[model samples]
Target: MIDIHSHILPFMDDGAADYDAALGMAQDALNDGISTVVATPHHANGVYMNPAGEIEESVRVLNAKLQEAGNPLLVLPGQEIRIYGDLLDDLERGQLLSLAGSRYILLEMPSSRVPRSMEETCHELIIQGYVPVIAHPERNAEVAEDPSRLVRLIELGALGQLTAQSVAGTFGSKLQKLSLELCRRQAVHIIASDAHDQLHRPFGLSEAYGVVKRELGSDAFDFFQQNSRKIITNEEVIRANPVQSYNKRHRLFGIFSRKG
Candidate 1:
């Protein structure tokens, strides 16, 4: 499996703290059958700001250690860029890091809600030649309540990724079911570990795949694996023709709730 988003870079952010922790996280992924892990440290998240160049260096050092340890995991440099106004400019000017120097960029938004300007920002990124992939939209309350709000992004040619834990019901049944719904509708593109540590948020993606396979079948398994591989290769992941969504109830609820 190719983990498109992760915070396993040592001392880069609030992820794996040191080289030991980073290697440990890699081992966790390796044991789970993950071969390539994109070391996506938080960038411009208002607290942990890992610059693109610094992240590249961190990956280089980590790769050396992995080689020395004879671990078969490949680490790549990427950034989980928080949604902000100046994203396109920062990326174009070489201030933002693409996924291992590819056109694919992993994007994260605020937790509670989807930003109003997010759709426009993604469109702008598309215009500027970057694929803006929203990370972990399943955990967003607004998205969970009304998943069709994400359809606008898909219409604009942007892709969506879900947290592996969310699919496993680590958050709750609402989020877990919503994530599967997105996959069923072909709205979700990739599933990533987004691991922080081995205790609370350990790197465990295999079990999540098991859940998906149980609920969604082998096709869903292939979807997550194939699409993640494409993102690693910086290739276009066209949606499996948009399915009919069972979202009319959600649309009505959203409308009635907003009438206050």
Candidate 2:
């Protein structure tokens, strides 16, 4: 399987702390049946800044190490860029890196809220021939309260990627339920392991796929898996029917009132 999002580059961002930890993360990914991973360290996320050229170099070194270790895992370059005002400018200036050198970009929104200019930024990126893939919308507080926010973004030519841990209930039952809901509603286009480490944030791609297959079906599983492959190869992905907007008041009340 191809994981389009992961912070597996050592000494980059808050992911693998050193070379040893990065190798361990790669091994964990292999154990989870992942053959390819995009090393998407944080970029312009207010904490870490992994430039495109630097990210490419890191991927090269990591891939060599994995090859020497006989892991059979391929590490590709990518960036989990936080949505910012100068995103387009940076991309033009060669500061931002797309997913595996494809036109697809993994965009990260603020955890608590969606910025007011997010839609505009996404539209601008689309106009500039970049496909913005929103990362982990299910975990965003605003999106959890109103899923239509994500649906709207999808309608705007932006894709959504759900994290494997979220789907497998690693974060919590609430996030797991929300992730499942996104899959059921066809609001998510891809499922990836946003793995940061081997212990706390281990790769759960296989488990997530099982959950998707059991809860949704084989067809859904195939769709997500195919999309991930398409992303790395720079091919057009298959999108399901647009998600229907839910009644915000009813959905929010039910979501909060559900028994754990």
Candidate 3:
């Protein structure tokens, strides 16, 4: 499996603290059956700034270390860029890194709220010939309250990636339910272990895949797996139909709720 989002680079951001920790994280990923991982350190996220060149170098160094340690996992370069006003400019200037150097970019929205210019920004990215992929939308507070916001983003040509921990109920039941709902509605395009460490943010890709297969089915699992691979290979991903908002009555009265 290919994990498109991770902070495994040493001393880059709030991910692995050092090379030892980074190697530990790689081992954990290997245990989870993930052979390929994108080292997506934070970039322009207000606190951390990881330029594309630096990220590429870090990936190179880490790959060498993995080879020395006899680990078969392959680490690729990427960035979890925060949505900012200069995103297009930076991307055009070759400062921003896409997922495994593919056309798909991992975009991170503020956790507190979706930016007011989000839709337009994503539209601009699409216009610029880049696929904007929203990372961990289920964890965004505003999006969790009104999932239709994400549905709208999807309608505008943006893809959504859910964190594996969220799907595995590691964050909480509410987020797990919301993640499942997004999958059922076909709003989610990928699943990634936004793993930060060996302990707290361990790789849960296999566990999350189990949950998706059990709850959603084999087809859902295949869809997510194929899309993830496609993104890394710069292939055009298969998109599902536009997602609709869940009925309010169903929320209040369970599955037996009648349409008004």
Candidate 4:
């Protein structure tokens, strides 16, 4: 499986602390049946600033470490860019890196709230021939309150990526419920292990896929896995299931349920 979002690069951000930790994360991912990972460290998020060139080089170094350690897992270049005013300018200046050089780019919104300009930024990115993928919307407080906000962005051509831990109920029951609801509504297009470490934020891709298959069924499982693969290959992502706009009020009264 290909995990499109991860922070496995050493000393880049709040991910792996060192090369040893990075190798450990790679081993964890390999054990989870993930053969490829996009090393998307935080960029322009007020603290760390990893440019395209630096991330490319960091991925190379990480891959070399993995190879030396006889690890078969592959690490690719990416960035979890927090949207800012001059983001388009940075993209034009070749500062931002897409997932594995694909047209799909991983974008991060503020954790607490979805920025007001998010929809417009997504539209602008689409116009520039880039696919904007929002990372971990289930964890965003505003999105959790009103899922329609996410559905609107999806309708505007943005893809939502649900974190594996959220689906596995690692964060909490509430987030797990919301994650499942988003999946049932087809609001999220892919599942990725936004793993930061082996202990706390470990790779849960296989386990989360198990939850998806059992709770949502085999078709949903296949749809998410295929989209992950398509992103790496730069192929057209197929959304076979029709998306449903989420109704927050109805969700509490049997709007979401386990497969019977």
Candidate 5:
């Protein structure tokens, strides 16, 4: 499996502290059936600033270490950029990194509220032929309060990615329910382990896939898995029509089925 988001690069941001910790995290991911991990360190998020060039160098160093250790896992360069007004300018300046050098850009928003410029930003990104994928929208308070906000973003051609731990109930039961709700609404397109460390945030992609298969069925599992592969290859992902008017009474009605 391909995990499209992670912070396993040592000394990059708040992820693994050192090479020892990063190697351990890579082993954990390997045990979880993940074969490729995109090292997405925080970029321009106030606390951290990982430029595209730096991230590429970091990924190369990590991959070299993994190779020396005889680990088969592949590490790709990426960045989890916090949305800001100067985002487009930064991208044009080649300071931002897209996922696996694909057209898909991993984007993060404030957990407290959706940005007022989100719609415009997403629109602008789409116009530039770049897909902005909002990371962990299920955990965002604004999205949890009203899922339609996420639906609106999806309609604007933005995608949503759910953190694996959120889907596996690691954060809490409430967030797990919301994660499943977003899945049912077709608002989320990918599942990734936004793993920081083995203890606090471990790799839960496999567990989350199991939950999706059991609760939503195997079709939903395949959908997310296939989308992850498509994203790294810069292919167009199949987006099901999101249920705009989410009804609690019909929670199980729209779980994803095989699209092709």
Candidate 6:
């Protein structure tokens, strides 16, 4: 399996602080059945800004360690890019990291507020031929309050990726419910372990898949996994399932606690 989001780059960001922790995270990913991981250290996230070039170098070094350790899992160059007006410029200038160096970039909106310019930004990114993968919308407070904003982002041709912990109910019952609701409405395109370590943010994409399997079915599980592979390969992503929209009222219902 391919884990499209992870902060495993050692001493780079809020992920691993050294090589020992990074190796531990890699081992955890392997145990979870993930064979590949995109080392998505936070980029342009103010406090922890990792550049595109640095990300490539980071992958190179980590791969060397993996090879030495005989670890089967592979690390890829990528970033959890923070949004700004200059996205297209940087992308055109070859200053971005995609998952596995594919055309699909993991783009981040502010956790505090869902970007109001998300629609236009995504449309522009698509026009530029780079697929923007919106990171962890289920955890965003604005979108939690009003999922219609997320619905609109999906409509504008951006794909949403849900965090594994969100599905496992790590953030809270509210986020877990929201994450499942996103799946039910087909608002989410992929499920990834946004793992930061072996403890708090453990590598557990399979466990997340289990939750998705129980909530949706084998079909939904395969749909996300298959398309996630396509995204990393730089291939055209087949939606697998038809694009489904949610009723506005359902968004409000999703914000509250889950009875079941």
Candidate of highest TM-score: 5
Better of 2 and 6 by lDDT: 2
Ranking by lDDT: 5, 4, 3, 2, 1, 6
lDDT of 2 by residue, 1-260 (tens): 99999989998899999988999999999988899999999999898988898999889999999888989999999999999888888988999999998989999999999999999999999999989999999988899999989989998899999999999888889999999888766678999999999888888899999888777677678889999999999999987555433324345332212233
- Candidate 2, run of 10 with poorest lDDT: 251-260
- Clash pairs for candidate 5: none
Cα TM-score per model:
0.91, 0.93, 0.93, 0.93, 0.94, 0.90
Model 5 spans with C-alpha error above 4 angstroms: 244-260
Model 1: residues >4 Å from true position, as ranges? 245-260
Query: Can you write out model 5's per-residue Cα lDDT over 1-260, one digit (the tens) per residue?
Result: 99999999988899999999999999999999999999999987889988899889989999999999999999999999999878999999999999998999999999999999999999999999999999999988999999999999999999999999999998999999899888888899999999999999998799999888888888789899999999998899878777644334345355553223
Q: Return the candidate ranking by TM-score, descending.
A: 5, 4, 3, 2, 1, 6
247 Cα displacement, candidate 5 (Å):
12
**C-alpha displacement of 236 in model 4, angstroms?**
1.2
Which whole-number lDDT from 0 to 100 does residue 21 have in model 6?
A: 94
lDDT of 6 by residue, 161-233 (tens): 9999899787788888889877766678888998888899887899888877777667678877887788778
Pull out the clashing pairs in model 3: none
Error of 6 at 217 (Å): 0.8
Which residue pairs of candidate 1 clash? none
Question: What are the runs in model 2 whose C-alpha is more than 4 Å off?
Answer: 244-260
The RMSD (Cα, Å) of candidate 2 is 4.9
Backbone collision count in every prediction? 0, 0, 0, 0, 0, 0
